[model samples]
Target: MNAPTVPVLQVHQLTKSVQLEDEVLHILESVELTINPSESVAIVGPSGSGKSTLLSLLAGLDQPSSGSIELMGKPFHDLSEDGRAAARAGTVGFVFQNFQLLPALTALENVMLPLELQGARDAEAKARHFMDEVGLGHRLNHQPGRLSGGEQQRVAIARAFATQPALLFADEPTGNLDSANSQKVEDLLFKLNAEFGTTLVLVTHDRELAKRCQRTLVLDNGTLVEAAHASTGA
Candidate 1:
């Protein structure tokens, strides 16, 4: 008999709000979701719909004002900031729109940083392998400033996948790139996911990107409005 599947990510009654002056601005309200392992999911919504906020909370990068998030089976709300950081180590990877590469670090070094932090002795080899996978082996020595937007993003993708995390989160990963580069990045994301079986959760406004996911969640007015065709700009 097959065992019941345990969700890789779980969110129940997730809500987030902040105090602005004398007013309380609610950013998210009763958001609930569950994601199984190795599933590719997209989070999409209009501006100010809390897509990024939801991503942050799910990734344990930030805590929600009133909610609990279970990521890879650990309750984030129950952990301290340092505890959450410890939990995320080696298990979660992030790709960002800005590339987030260190200006002074070469592509190789930037990709190696996370592995080194995790005390992997083969950091160089792994970084090299992922760089090659992303078609940037020749650009290993190039600094972020010396690389084009697409190349830098490719490096970021390499960095994210080098750790072989169980879960990957990306926030508008191709937003800063041109259409050509965007397509390249989009391709790389699904390729890596297929190759690694990494559960992917992305927050993107790109309809094409959303369509590529196995499923999509539409966030509107701080709530999830389930849709059958999320890529249709629902």
Candidate 2:
């Protein structure tokens, strides 16, 4: 039989630090983690515990001060900015807490942007389909300012999925919403995950949302610890 495939993401001895005036502030220490393909995992921790830092590193949005990260069988540290961007274009999608949609662009335009960037010929049609999937069909022509927070987030989700990314990273995706809207977004997120088999890595404070994932990794002062199965609802 064939050997098991390597994980989609691997981090080894990752560390990060910054110089401040006269002292070096250590933000992360020897962080190590692995995320398999199509797996859903949550990173939960208090503010400033380096949860966002770890997510950025995993997504190739930022580099570690030491050690290495491998994604999709490529060494992340070895890739240049352009190369990393290309890699992400091919394999990763990110949903920000602020819904990062371009204010000037309509919802449909925002959702179509990535596909167009990738030179896909059917960008419009594909974007439309994903918008409908996220229950944003009626809001296609609306700009970010005109939509509700939940609607804006749904558009962001559609944009992220438009690329059919192998991995999805979400940073406090429901942070700005009320409970009802948060639940709605959460349901949509899992629905898309189930339908597309997209691996999920979420950084959140919501225990209920974290519980829905297959595994949860807790970060404390930048070091990682596996949470109990009960904590993860695994």
The local distance difference test score of each candidate is 0.90, 0.90
Model 2: per-residue Cα lDDT over 210-230, one tens digit each: 998989899998789989765
lDDT of 1 by residue, 124-214 (tens): 9999999999999999999999999999999999999999999999999989999999989999999999889999999999878898888
Clashing pairs in 1: none
- For residue 160, give model 2's deviation from the true position in Å: 0.3
Candidate 2: residue 4 Cα off by (Å): 2.6
Task: List the candidates' TM-scores in order.
Answer: 0.95, 0.96
Q: Compute the lDDT for candidate 2.
A: 0.90
Clashes of each: 0, 0
Cα lDDT, model 1, residue 32: 86
| Residue pairs with backbone overlap in model 2 | none
| Model 2 misplaced regions, further than 4 Å | 230-234
